[model samples]
Structure formats: structure tokens, C-alpha cells
Target: MQTAQRNSLKLLQWMMAASLALPLALFAFASAMSWISTSEAADQEIQRTLDVAHEHALKVFETIDRSLAEVTEVIRGMSDADIVAREKGLHARLRVVAEALPQVKSVWVFDANGRALVNSLVSPAPDVDFSDRDYFRIPAERDIGTYIGEVLTPRPPYLGARFFSVGRRRNNEDGSFGGVIQASVLPEYFENFYAKIGREPGSFLALIRTDGAVLAHFPVIDHAVRFEPSGPLGRQIVANPLAGARTLQSPADGIERRMRYQRLAEYPIYVSAGLETAAIRSRWVSTVAQHLIFGIPATALLFGLLALAYRRTQRLEEEASRRIEAEEALRHGQRLEALGQLTGGVAHDFNNLLTVIRASVDMLRRQDLPEPRRQRYIDAISNTVNRAAKLTNQLLAFARRQTLKPEVFDASQNVRTLSEMIATLIGSRIEIAAQVPDESCLVNADAGQFETAIINMAVNARDAMDGVGRLTITVRPVNDLPSATTGPPNPHGHVAVSVIDTGVGIPPELFGRIFEPFYTTKEVGHGTGLGLSQVFGFAKQSGGEVTVTSDVGKGTTFTLYLPRVVGEHSPQSLLAEDAPSVDRANASVLIVEDNAEVGKFAADTLTQLGCTCVLVENATHALEELAVDPSRFDLVFTDVVMPGMSGIELAEEIRRQGLDLPIVLASGYSQVLSQQGSGGFELLQKPYSAEQLARLLHKAARSRRLRRDQAPAG
Candidate 1:
């Protein structure tokens, strides 16, 4: 009987649990249904809003198109004499037409030579030449029926506001092209009309050409007259030429929005309207919150009661399990965040570099450009390429993958050399105050990396100061150092190169994390978070360390401690030793590159540098050519990362064979070069300029000659 009573007690508990869970589940289902209904309604409302906006845009374009057509017809029927004479009747008709359409800014008729024959405004119009205008030139060249020109700032008699032109090609009685009848429409008209149509605060209305130029936009103050057709919006238009709706992230503001676009039937213009996702989500969230507010209290009450009853049964096990899980989750999240930041920064920087390169190349391809301007474009391309190479070098430094070509040089001299460049980079707002010791504090490290580190630190300091502050770069010898967050002291003594700035100082707690890759305190798009990481990597790789000292309101100092090298050589001597004069006459360069394009490029460049070139695909072929007659090649130019046999292996082979030839290994980023240490051979970083290649080749040839002369009498 006691056993039966215990079973009944367990059954009663189970029944109560079921009774509580059923209503809660049903309430959740009902809430989910309500949310779905609400979301659907919001989406429909957004569609309706877009439709209204599209219709309004279409009506505006139609009005402009009709007015232009009417003006074109009126001009075609009139004699050239009537237009040039500014006949009173013709002037009245033109004025009436311009007055009838609110969109029409002005109506003008031009003769075959592009002289302003007649205009709606100003009876005696100023002698303006319309011949140079794109609207006139395009129709005149293509002999098209109608053409729409890009937005342009209007001339006198009209306010200094932007307008787009709709022009029709006029013909003479003999069927020859007789200039164009151009009608201008004020962009403000469309902006004003769009403003009257209600929209959310962040919403935008835009009229864009099929080719991607922005004709007009609502909230005109924020709109750019020109937007790249290759941009996000342009790509979208190309994907769906007609009418469509899509969710896109705005490049302008980085906001995700649902955009509806329609291509106008009468004109080559398209209209787009966007509603921010945040606004839509807000409405949906409110609906969900309303249901949750009432249901949550009841649900919580029941769950709390059940939890209270069940707590003692599983508390210890649950607590221990949760603790382990939480720790693991935190670690995983941290790793993912770091990876994301690193990739994001790399992509952002490379994209910017590519944009500059692409734009410069495009400009260089223009045929009608003057010789001086053409040279300027070529120089711009070269400079941009160098900048890109530097960017990649910085990335390699941060990754600890770069092959450093360390040279013993004075830090003070390098700092002084870079002071002017630093001033320009940081802009006029920040004053650069460099204090270099009169005596050289020699250090063995890559001068380029050292300069890069200082520049990165200076830029960080500049940002911290909000672009306005005094920056002081000082180089002094440090005999003793206390080990702390900066790093351990070097037994060989160190040269302290410090970049000091009056900027917002870093917090103490973040000191340990600042050197970690992708760890930055800057806002997104403002920084890549790789600058400090590069500095840290560079300092550590150079047999030294980087340290920072800061005060909350005062300022901050970043010191790079490099092991001092006791040497008599000055910085200028080191530069002279590195770069030798090139006499490329009779020099034969054996180019070994696996990539066909790269091999061809190397051969062409060497030929241009006044060298006889022999191109080979790989190390085996290069060895064969050398074996045929080793003396035929004055220098062996090879890529480090190659298939079959690596450049380092080939260099080792050449040494093993006792070849008199000098080897120059080139690479953009090579693991082999980093691992094998360039085997004491001359290393050339890829994307090397013609001058750099020439100098390196010259140095290698000279080294070969010296080795030959040093050998015992043959």
C-alpha cells in the first residue's frame, strides 16, 4: 500500500508538468503566427511605398522627355535665319514652352557651328559656345536621334545649379548634321518632388543613368553628382535591367537596406528607392515584443517554479559543465574574431591599392591625352604600384613571413631621411619634430622595415591626436633596460628609436593585447589593426623589442629597441654599398621563371635595360644552359618560389658546381627565402623597378668579377 501511494505521488507531479507546458507551447505557436503575419504586412507596405516612388520618378522623367521633344520639333521647323535673328514670334513660343514645364530649366537652339542662335531666357543671349559641350559633341559625332548628357553646372543667366541635358540632332535641308537642339532640366526639380513624397529618415530616392551616372537624388545635399557605374548599385542594375527588389548593403553608409529599382520606359534613366533594414526590423521586433511581454511573465513563473523544484537534483553537474563550455566558447570566439579582423584588413587595403592602379591604367589608355599628361599618368601608375608593393610588404611583416635583408646602418640617419616624408604623410596639421643624435647609433636590420615601423607608429600617433599634434622622433642609445611590457633587454646593448606624440593615450589594460594581430582600438574602415602587429613583428625579428609608455591625459611614446651594431660605416655608406652603378652593355642575363608571363616580362625588361637575355622555364633548363657554356651568362636572375627546383636549391647547386656566375633571387613573398635565408645570395624583392633591377644586376656582376679575381692563379 505504501508503494502504491509513492507511485500516485510521482504521477501527480508528471500531470502538473504536462498541464503547464501545453499552454506555454500553444502561446509560443500563436506568437510565431502573429509575427509572421506582421512581417508579411510590413514587406507589402514597403513594396507599395517603392511602387509610389517609382511612379513619381517616372512621371518626372516623362515630363522632361515630353518638353524636350516639343522643343526639338519647334526648332527643326524654324529657319536658321529666324533663330539667329531672334524673331519675336519664335522667342515668344520658346519662352511659352519653357514656362509651361516646371522641369525645363532652359531651352536653347544652336547652329551647325555650335553658336547659340536662340534661347528662352535673355532675348539677346550672351555669345556662348555650346560646341564644346558633351550633349552637342556626342549627337554630332554619333548622329544619333537623341542623347542625354551627364550632369553639368549651368552657365550665366541660370543659377549656378547642376542640370542634365536632353538633346536632339538637327539636320540641314541637304541632310547634313546641323548642330543640336538642347533642353536642360534642373536637377533640383526632381529633388524637390522626391522630398514631397514621404519617406523614412535614412531612406533615399535616386535617378541614375543606365550607364551609372547619378542624374539627380533626393536629399540632394548628400548626393554625389557622379557615382561609378561599376559600384554596388550599378552591378545591381546590370543584373536586373527591368524592375526588381533586393536587399543590399549601402557602400556610402554601410547600412543594409531593401531597395526597389525600376528602369524608365521612355528614357535611359533608372530610379531606385531604398528603405533601411533597421526600420523594418524595428517594426517586426515591436510586434514580437508585444506578444512576448504578456506571455513571458506566465512562462517565467511556471519555469521558475519547476526549476526551483529540480535545482538540487542537477546543480553541481550543470555548474561544472557550463563553466567548461563557457571557457571553450570564449576562446573560440576570440580566435574567430582575430581571423575575421586580419582578413578584413588585408582585403580592405588591397582593394584600395587595386582601385588606384586600375584608375591610373585606365587614364593612361586614353589616346588623345597630351604627352606631359601621359607621362604624369605613367608616373602615377608606377608610384601606385610601389605603394601596393609596400602594402604587401607590411602584410608579410605582420605575418612574420618576409625575408629581411638586414644591413648595419645608423638609425638616426634613417629617421632624418624619413622626417620629410612623415610630414607629408601625416599632413600639415601635425608638426614633425625629429631629434637625431649627431653620432650614428648603428643597428643591423632592414632599413625599409625600420622606416615602415616608424611610419606606422607615427600614423597611429597622428590618428590618436585626431590629425593635429606634435610628433617627435628620437634616436638614442640605450645601455640599460628594465624588462616589462616592452620586451627583454638585449645583452649586446640597444638603440632606442622612439616615436612620441601628444595624443590620446592607450589604456593600461590593453597594453598586453596591442601587439596581437588584428587587435585595434580604432573604428571599422578607419584602421586595419595590422600596423602595431607589423611593428611588433619587425622589432622581434630584428633581434630587438618594441615598448610603449603612456599617460591617460598627457601623451604616448612607442620605442623600438634594436640591438646596436658597433660599426664604422655610416648610413650613407651602407646605401652606397647596396646600390651600385649599372653598365648593362654586353651583360647577358639568364632569366629562370616558371610563369610564362613573368619570364617574358623579365626578358623584355632586361633587353630594355641593355642586356642580352636567355629565358628558361625552370632550374633544370637553366642548369643545362649554364652547362653549355657557363661564361655565356654574366648574371642568373631567378624567382625564389618556382616549381621543380626552388631558387635557393639552384643557388646552392651553382655554388656546389663552383660556377663563377652570381645568382640574384627574386620573390614577392617566399617561404623558401624566409626558411633558407637567401643562402648569402643577393635577394631582389619582386615588383622591382627598372632602376632597382639594373642596380642589383650591376652589383651581382661586380661581385662575380671580384670572386674571379680573388681565385688562385688558374
Candidate 2:
């Protein structure tokens, strides 16, 4: 009987091992499949984002082009000599027409000599030179039927405005060339026209110039404005402008995103729109996480039932189940950990994307659209951009990319302004008071960041006061005094912004560690513990510091010390140079550009500015052009990056040929220009407007002219 019992025990051990093995294999297979599906879903989400971006971008291009074409037609009508010679009578008629056209920021007539004959903005003045402007020269070249220039920030007659000027060459009644008729339109004219687009909270649309400068961003103030890609996806799209829909992880918040972008065929512009996956597929992620967590255990229970059925006829199966239980628990924990990491990565990318979209929208709002139809479309665009901004703020608050935009401003005024907002923020549970002096105290800090810091302090106070508290904010000028608790004397003049709360004070021991990232005193799900860290970061970034003064039951006061600017600091204006005369006498120009648009623009611009332009695509082409007739070209205008050889290489080749053709290398990126710095050659940035192009060509042409004039006349 004893021998029979030992054999049964061995058999039970084998059964236990088999039971664990069967469920383990099934669970492993299920986990792999789930992860693969999640990854594929993430990729699909990215593609969808790209598709949306492309459609929105295409719309911006079409709207801008169609509007310009319509304006061109209008200009063709005004080009009549009867209208041009009437002068004052024509001005009265134009004003009547301008008032009727809301999109027309300004409608002007230029004489054959490019002198302003009638301007809608002011009484016709000839002070400005239309001859040197792009709106005049670009259409005159007729290289492209229509054009869209880069966004120019607030200038004369258009304060804090961004608009595209549409132009067409005018002709005299005798069929001779008149000059040009032009109109500048703000995108707001089209804003309401495109209001049909339904964009999610975190989605955005942007109208970008060919060279990558943002022509118009939705939400103007909230949208991203930089030409190059800001986050990872933006970088990828820029690297390959022709890319269709694609997915990318943004570094700003580490969220997986979908982007759609398309370049306009006629204009040098692209319109793009994108959506965050979290906003679009939040349900999917939640479902995936839920099933992965609960499905395995439930499925395991089903397998256990099968095991019980097998053991029903065999009582010995229960003796060796400990090892099986241990293996199952370990495997389940492993799968959960993997899922967590995957989900976290996806969330981060989503948050980063929202941050960028919001910033882009903000930038877009800054654009001033004048065309009624275009402005209506842009208004719609602005709405979409604003939604994108709201989405980003949430994501940034989650991912901690939301930093401060500090400017020197009066501290007391800021505190006083926050009075109403703080009251609304704290609700009826907290009473707020501002103890600020009337004298102006300056602090270099972001108004929003300051408000957030105050809100956080108020919340902490409310919590200490057990959901009720009194909050007092004070601002004062800081002189040569050691801070409330500092070891050294103040050097930089400072302003003290203090938030005092009648709440349970923080322990002294926890003071130094409170500002550590992710360190929170609140319970789980209550906070991410980044509030104080953000406050700390804001202070440090503003060239200041945050100090705390608190006693066990004496309440807490968080004081932010910020550097004060002496007197005042105003924005410096770019030094403007008088337009130089185009002296092309005997100047020959060598133009190298791989892209036809840029190369043609440079060459035609040079020729117009009075130089013989020799066009080439690469270094080899330039060398070949020079080999045939070395003296044909006097100055070489080449792009830095080319197909066969670079601009630097081509310059070297010219030096080897013993030719001193003044070389002007143009590039879009500053890095390449910096690399060729001070090499006795001038470098011009690409996507240069007509005036800039004219200026650079003249500089090169005049330099060559001087060299020739100095040399013995051959």
C-alpha cells in the first residue's frame, strides 16, 4: 500500500507541471499578439494624423491662390489708363471700391516708374519705392502666374498685422506697360469662409511659406511658427517635404501623433493639420489596457476549470500545485509591466504633440488677414488652431513641457490684475487679498507662470486650512538686502513676489526635496507633484530664486525673487540702409541653384538689378560654364548644397581657375552659412525676399564693378 502511494504522488507532480505549462504558453501567445496590435494601432493613428494635416494644408493653398487670382483679375481692370490718369477722381473711386472690399487692406496704383499714384491706406504718397519691392518685381518677372511671400511682422500702416500682397502688371491705354496694381489682404477675410472644418481640441492647421516660414498659423497666438520642424514629427516632415501621411513621436510630450501635410503646386506654401492619438483613440488605448490586464486572469481561471475537470477522477492532483501557482503569478506580473511601459511611451508622445499644436495655433492668431473670403477661412483656421492650443496645454501640464515666457513687467500690477481671477480660482472656500504697493516693482517673469505659482500656493493653503483659507499676495522692490533667508548680499536688483497662506506649514526637513521633479506630498491620483518644481524652474529661468519661510503651525509663504531691469529696456530696431543704386556696368553673375524656383528667382533678380546672370545647377555645371568662357561671369551666386558639388567646392574651383569672381553662397540653414563665415566671400540666406535679393546682388555686383574700375582699363 505504501509503494502504491509513492507512485501516485509522482504522477500528481507531472500533472501539476503540465497544467502550468499549458496556461503559460497560451498567455504568452496572447500577450505577444496584443502588443503587436497596439503597435500597429499606434502607427495607424500617426498615418491618420498626417492625412488630416495634408487636407488642411491643401485648403490653405487653394484658398490663398484662388484669392490672389481673383485680386489679379481686379488689378487688370484698374490698369486702364483712363483710371490711372484721372488721379484724384480715380482715388475717390478707389476708396469707394476699397470700402466695399473688406479683404482689401490697401489697394494702390503705381505709375510706370513704380511711384505710388493712389494708396487706400493714406493720401497717395511717393515716399516709398515700389521699384525695390517684391510685390512689384516678382509679378513683373512672370516666372510664376501668382506668388505668396513670407509672413512679415507688424510694419507701417499694418500694425501687428500679417498679410500677403497680390499684384499684377498694369498696361497703359496705348498697350505700353503701365506699372503694377497691388492689394494686401489679411487672412481674416477668409476666416469665416472655411468654418466648416471640424477640428478636435488638440488639432491644428497652418499655412506655411515655401521656405518653411509660417505664413499663417491657426489661433495665431497659440500655434507653432518656426519654419523647421519643432518636435520630432515636424523635423521629419521638413527633412522630406514630399512625404505623405506619417506618424512620429514628438519629443515635447512623447505622444504618438498623426500628421497630414501637402505642398501647394503653384505657391511656395504647405498647409498641414494633425491630431493627437489620445484625443482620437482614447477609447482604443483604454480598451487595450483593460483587456490586457483583466483578460489574462479571467482566461487563466477558465484553464483552471479544465484542470479541475481532469482532477475530478484523480484526488492526488492537488498535492503539487504550489509550483504551478508561483509560475503563473510571475508571468502575469511580467506582462503587466510590459504593457505599462508601452502605454507610458504612447502617452508621452501624445502630450508632446498637443504642446506643439497649441503653440502653433497661438502663432497663427497673430496673422492679420484682410481678404473677406480668405479672412473668413482664416477665422475658421484660427478656431481650429485655438482648439489645438487647449489640447497642448493639457498635454504640457501632463508632460511638464509647459514652461514660462518671462518679460520684465510691474509686479504690483500683475498681482492686482490677478485679484478677480484668483477669486474665481479659489472659489468660496478661500479668501484672497493683494498687499501690493502703488509704486511699480519690475520682475522678469511670465505672467501666466506667476499666476500658476500663485494658484498652487493658494491650493496648498486651502488644503492646510482644511478646504478653507486666507491667501495674501504681496509685491515689493528688492534692494541690497540679503533675501528673507539668504547667505549673500543681492547683486542684481530684484523684485519680491510673495504668496502668504494661513495653512499648515511644510516640515523644514522636507523643504529641500520638495522641488524635486515628480516628488509630491499629496496622495496618488491627486497630483503629479510638478507644481513646485515648475515654480522652481520658473524662478531659476527668470534669473531668480524661490525661497520658503514656514513654521510647523505658523503657515507658509513662498517668495519668488526675480531680477529687475534697470530703468527700461526697449526693443532695438534693425539698422536700415538706404537703397543702393543698381550699378551693373560690367558685372557678370554666376547663379547656381538646384531647385528651379530658387535658382530662377536669384538669376532673374540679379539680371533685373543690372548684372549679366550665368545660371548653373551644380559645381560641375559652373565649372563647365566657366571653362567655355572664364570671363563670362563676374560674380558666382551658388547655393550651399547642390547635387554634384557644394557651393564651397565650387568657390574653391573658381579660385583654382585663377578667377576672382566674387562668390555669394546662399543657404536656408544658418549652419552652412556659419561654416563658410568670413572666408572673404558674402553669404546670403535663402528664401530671401525681393528687396533682400536685390540688396545682395547689388553688393556683389558693385563689389565686382569696383574691382574692375580699380584695375587698369583693358
Candidate 3:
């Protein structure tokens, strides 16, 4: 059983571990995947930002080219002479187009010699020398489609916001290089658009020319910080010119970032967007922390349950082991104790009986004994023998082996009759009261044992009251009484006879043991402790029960519940019997007993009562005498238990052979008689007087003759 329990606990512990472990394991895997996903997400975000910046740069360049084309159409087929000639009207047209664009600060028309013909801010065509500017110088050196100039704040006489210039080379009708069509682009316009993209902290965006000049930056730089052409990002850009991304340090802020760059389709311009590595890491950390917050406590709770179960299991095993040892020790002590008490109780009571018989016999040996004194001594021995017999019966009663002769009798009247004798038994100091119902409470039980039970209870009450308290005996019919053993209540009624006493009551703790034999609370000589046990056994054997209720300082009530038999009875009166007359004239007796002396004593005693006596040591010898003439002996008087073919068997054999002899079986206490029954024979209990033997023999013989005379002829 313990092993099964441990196995179950182990199974439960494993289940608990698995229940939490499975989810936490999945959560841990998910957290790792989420971290990787965050990193991938950071790279994707950077690429998308770069795309936005790339598109914005393309749109700015497209506007610049469009404005330059309109101006070129206005100057179609015209020289620097014609361009200066239409300069006023052209200046108004350039200013009208630049005013339409938020990003275009101004526009200039310069000839091949780098002399400005028309400009948007000063309409009369200011004499701005653009030959020194990169827009003009780069285009003059190499016939490029368009040249992107370095960012510059307009100096004196160049009125507008900070801007970079986009310039296109013009061709003559013969396809020779013409002057540059210059448009000033505002850097703040792209900066405002990048800021509007709403990147998180530590992120950066920029519009960069392939030549490593930053046109626009977000957050816009206060000081001019040029991009490194040979750094990590720059080297990557040089390796893969169109588009690339890498983890690199920012040249402006020196922060590590994942930076991506994309080149616009039609221009020598690249857009770069970078996200700080630390910010990406923070996102990954936040996801992992959430999983930990939920999983850690659940894991702890699983282990906590296992620890508690382990502690409880260990404690139970230790306690169970101790209990086993204690129970073994208790059982051993009880066996030895029970045997000793049984022997002591029988020996103690029998020794008193022996003392009486011994003393009386010793007195009978006196040579000068007077007749009256001899009779008294004889009576003492006789009474003591009866006492020894009664004590044996009391032992059997407690054991529930006593053969009972039951009759239906009124329980109320019985107790009332005993009420007078009870006063003499307990004493007059205690008040006696009897409460009996008008209807008789009849019960089929051994009258003698019932009376004995009542007397035992009254005696105990007297002792409890210390000889001076109220004693009440009540008898009434009851139905549906609850069983004493805690079984279902009896629907059939019972007669309840209660003996109540106003004395220091029984303590509740001692209620269970009060019915155990030789277990007494009285002083050593005052009780044999068989009284209540006799009550217990008698009630049980009679198909009834006994119960008790008590309060320590108030009183106690002992109730005996017997199955009530349906009957009406006239009130019974106690009667006394005179000395029985014995007539054993012309009687023939056959005695079968195992003991030689006891057989001889019976035969000799019957011989004095005028009976022919035959003695045998066992049933075999008695059968030998009966084989000669079965009818010669009037009665077969035998002991019930013997060595071989016991007296009951012998009597059975005689009846089988159709003998007319009557069988009279006797014993002080025979297992066969107590258990099987008295087998249709006159029973004379042993240690009997000659008069008892004589009376039984005459009765058996007379009964046989009467039966024979009553037989009809065939």
C-alpha cells in the first residue's frame, strides 16, 4: 500500500513538472524566436526608411530637372545675346515657376562663361558669378547630365534659405556645351520631410551625394559634418554602389547602428537610414522579459508542490512505521495480560469455595460432634458446592456459553419484585424507587440471568452512590431503539430496563472498558468485575443490547434493552420452595463415569437411597453390563463427557437399540451439554447430594414406566 502511494506521488510529481515544464519550454523557445524576429524587424525598418529617403530625393531632383527644362525651352535657339535680351521676361517666368515649388528657393540662367543671365530672387538678372561654384565647375570639367553642388548658405546678394544647387549642362544647336541652368534647392525642405517620418530615438536619415557630401540630415546637423568616404558604411557603399546595409559607427554621433543606403535611379544621390543597435537590443530584451515574468513563478509553484508532497510523504512513512511497532507491542502485552487475569479470576473465586469445603470437612471429622453442629457443617459444605457451581455458571454467562431456559415474563414486575430484595442487598441508606408502566413489558430471556443482571446493576449503583444516593429502576416498552453498536435502529420494539443512580458518575473515557471482565474500578476485594461483563454477554446472547449514559459529577444510567415478546402476563409473585422429598425405592441405576472414585461415590450414594447400583469407569464398561440385559437397569445415569464413547454417545446407542431404560446425564460443566444441548435426557448437575441423585433417578424411572403404560398395543 505504501509503495502504491509512493508510486502515485511520483506520477503526480512528474505530471506537475510536465504541466509547467511544457509551457515554460515553449515560452523560452518563443522568446528566442522573438529576439531574432526583432533583429530582423530592425533591419526591415532601416530598409523601409532608406526607401522613403530615396523617394524624397528623387522627387526633389525631378522638380529641379523640370524647372530647368522649362527655362531651356524659353531660351531655345538663343545665344547669350538672345538670353540677355529676353532676360527680364525670362526672369519673371523663372520666378513664377520657383514660387510654385516649396523646395525651390530660386533659379539662375548662366551662360557657358559662368555669368548669370537671369535669376528668380532679383528679377533684373543679378550679376552672380557661378563659374567658381561646383555646379558650374563640375559640369564644365566633364559634360555631366546634372551636377549636384555642395550645400551652401547664400552669401551677400544671394537672397534665400540655405540650399544646394542642381545644375544641368546646355548644348548648342551644333551640340556644343551651353551654359548651366541652375536651380537652388532648400535643404530644410528634405529635413522637414525626414523629421515627419517619425523615427524612434537614436535613428538617423540623410540625403547623400555619391561624392560623400550630405545634402540633408534628420535631425538636421547644426555644424557641417561630412560623410566618410573610406569608413565602414562608405567602404560598403563603394563596394556595392547601388544599395547596401551594414552595422557601422556613425561619423556624426559615433553611435553603432545598422545603416542602409539606396541610390536614386536618375541621380548621383544616395539616401541613408540608420537605426541604433542599442534600441533594437532593448526591444528584444523587453519581449524576453515578458516571458520570464510569467514563466518563473509557474515553475516555482511546480517545485513548491513537489517539495510539500515530499515532506508529507516522509512524515507519513515515519508515523506509519512507529504505529506498526507500537501495535505489535500492545498486542503482545494484551495477550499475556488477558491470560493472567483469566487464570487469576477463576483461581481467586475457586479458592474461597475450597476454603469453605475444607473447613467444613475438617469439622465433620470431630468424634464428639453434636447432631445440630454436624447438620450445620454439612449445610455449609453443601452451600459452598452450590456457590462453586454458580461461579462456574457466571464465567460461562460472561463468555455467553451458559445454556439458558427462557420464558416470556413481565420485566416491570420482575424489577418490582427485586426492589424489596435490592434494599436488603445494597442497604437502606439509599432510597429505592421503581417506575413501571401500566402495560407489561414482556421479554423472552433467561429469568435467572435477567434478575442477576438487574441485581449486578443495583449493586454497582450502591457502590457508586457510596451507600447513600437515590436508585431508580424503570421498565417500559420502546420501539425503534437505536442499536448500541451504532447500527440502524430497530423498528420492532424492545423492553428497556434501566438502573439509574444519583452518584458520582462514570467518566466518559472509561465507558468502553466497563464491560470487560475482571476490569474493575472498585477496590481489590469489592469486585470481581464480572458483573457488567455478564450483563454485556447476556444481553448480546439474548439478541439485545446494553447501553450507558453518564455525567461525571451527576449520575449514571445503565439500560438493558431486550427484544420484547408479544404476551400478556399475570403479575408474578416470588415463591419459596420447601426441602424436596426423595423416594428412590426399588430403583436400579447404572452409572458411567471416567473417574473410578467418582463412579463409586455415586453408586454408593444411590445404594443408601434404596437403589440397586452398578458402577463403571467408562462407557465401554457400562455398555458391557447393559449388553447382558438392557431392561435390567431402570435408568442409565452417566456423566456426559468421558474418555471413550462419551455418555451422550452411549445413551444414543441404547436408544438406537430400543432400550426402555431412561438416561439421566449429569455434569458440573460439560462442553457438549453447554453447547449441543441436553439430549432429551434428565440432567443432574454434578457435585450433587444423594437426595438430588435419588430424586432424578425416581423421576426418570417413573417417567419411563408411565410412558410404557400409555403405549397402545399394535
Q: Using lDDT, rank the candidates from best to worst.
A: 3, 1, 2
Better of 2 and 3 by TM-score: 3
Quick one: best TM-score, which candidate?
A: 3
Candidate 2 structure quality by residue, lDDT tens digits, 337-388: 9998968866776566556556655655665744674555545555555555
List CA RMSD, all candidates.
33.5, 44.5, 30.3
Q: Which residues of candidate 1, in runs, are more than 4 Å off?
A: 1-42, 222-227, 251-254, 304-714
Candidate 1, poorest ten consecutive residues by summed lDDT: 569-578
Residue 652 error for model 1, in Å? 84
Candidate 2 local lDDT, residue 634: 65
Best by lDDT: 3
Estimated TM-score per prediction? 0.39, 0.33, 0.41
lDDT of each: 0.77, 0.63, 0.80
Name the TM-score of candidate 3.
0.41
Give candidate 2 misplaced runs (Cα > 4 Å): 1-116, 119-142, 166-198, 218-224, 229-243, 248-256, 277-284, 293-297, 303-714
lDDT of 3 by residue, 258-318 (tens): 7888888868888889888898889888888888897788778877777787668755765
Candidate 3: list runs displaced more than 4 Å. 1-30, 313-714
Per residue, candidate 1 scores C-alpha lDDT tens digits across 1-714 of 344444444554674576577766876787678667765665576667667867876776667667767766666666788776655666677788788888877777778878777777867667777788889888888676657788887766557567889788888878788778878888888778777764665566777778877787765664455546777666767788887777777655567877777887757777777667787777667777877787778777776676655454233444555676789999999999999998889898888878877887898889898899888878878878878878887887566677576677878988999999999999999989999889878887788889999999999999999999899999999886546634434555889989999998988998889888788888989998889987877776565778899997778999998878784654442223346557765578899999898889878877887778999999999999999999878899999988889988998899899987878888878566533445445677777777766776666567767777898995
